[model samples]
Target: MMRSLGKQTVRTHYQHIVAGVHDPEHDHTHETRQTVYERPDGTFQINYMSGKRFVMATNDGSFECVHVVQTVRSASGSTIMSVIAGAQSLAVNRLNAVIEFESGDRWIEIEDDETARLAAGLTQTAVGHFYHEEERLEGRHLRRWFVLVGPSEDLAVVGKVALFVLPPHETSVDPEVVDCHIAGYRNGNPYPEFAAEIEALAAATDLPITPNYMGDPVVTPPATGRTPGL
Candidate 1:
């Protein structure tokens, strides 16, 4: 289970070590002492390095994910600090995955592999907005197709599962547009089975189905494959 803000209020202190330091007159080692206070209602505070402080709070529990990144630069004592908050951890994971994927070869070959293709499709559905305008539009269109078929709880599950199986920093289609180009045959009638396959794949991989923000139960598919009139 993902980390949740529960009734486990605690305070802790630790040393964060920074490696690979070379100083002419010093011992060539450095570490920072940090203190953290976590509350049961998902609020937390951190203090480090001469009164520098970071804090986060949740009111109605809309936000659940938080990430802190520290970057060190070679140029004359340069450092960067970043804090990110999200509604769910999956979004943050997918963002990290996209970043890693983009930092390397953006293009890859799907080679008619069904699983890879499916993964690509789900990526398009989920984070395609991170891509260029054309590719983002494509993703929007595909999402529209799913919406037209009527909203199902499985849609989000399939999307998250696909993201889990996707290769790090790689896409089988054109990296420029981040296009998956799923076949037309799989779009309309076969979508239910397609969704089922994705769920099965996720189960095979032991990927947990992320609960909705409200923690609702999963529902069955609607009787009609396509939404009425479209």
Candidate 2:
């Protein structure tokens, strides 16, 4: 040891310490609906529910916008059939194919294959039906109607009439526009009384009416004497 005193060595010891800092609680209920952003590219994107960004795009670098006016979901949240049904209801029309006239006070409704497939996925019944009849000396009239009886007891009737516009004209209830206008019925029965509303809707969006008889005709009820009551 004395002889080795000329050579000396140094040693050091290091110890590590770890600790966690307490974090404040957050109120998730205070969170607001995620805002959709319009990108510089003229496209809109939103990350909604489960990290899915529903995107709408345009070919000309224009933005596609959509306001989700409604939503439906199953209690388990795993079954989105109701939402699909609602979406289909919003986008599909009464006349996806040719109309077949059936005679009777009761009409047998039939939907096109595409409409039927979409409707079938959401409900246990027909997506909708078509009723038609011919006049003695006049042309035939067809009415396409959809009846959606809600799980919450709400009832809705969706009707689309076909019309004839002149040459170089387009059909009313064109499948594309029809889907967007379908939301109009969500407020009330899409009947003759809603003609003004329909016309307004059509005018605002430049939607053309079909070239056939697709709109409801206004009919005034006949006057009658008051019935005697016991």
After TM-score superposition, what is the CA distance of residue 111 in candidate 2 from its true location, in Å? 18
How do all models score by TM-score? 0.21, 0.21
**lDDT against the true structure, each candidate:** 0.28, 0.29
Writing each residue's lDDT as its tens digit, candidate 2 over 1-230 gives 11111211111111211122222231011111123465666545554323434344346533333332223345667325345545654554433323222210011123344543443233322122111111111232222333222222331212232222222232333232122212112122234433433344334335443311122232432223332111
Identify the leading candidate in terms of lDDT: 2
Q: Residue 153 error for model 1, in Å? A: 22
Candidate 1 lDDT by residue in tens digits, 138-210? 4422211111111134333123222222233434342322222221121222334334433333343343432
> Per-prediction RMSD in angstroms?
19.6, 27.3
lDDT of 2: 0.29
Clashes of 2: 12
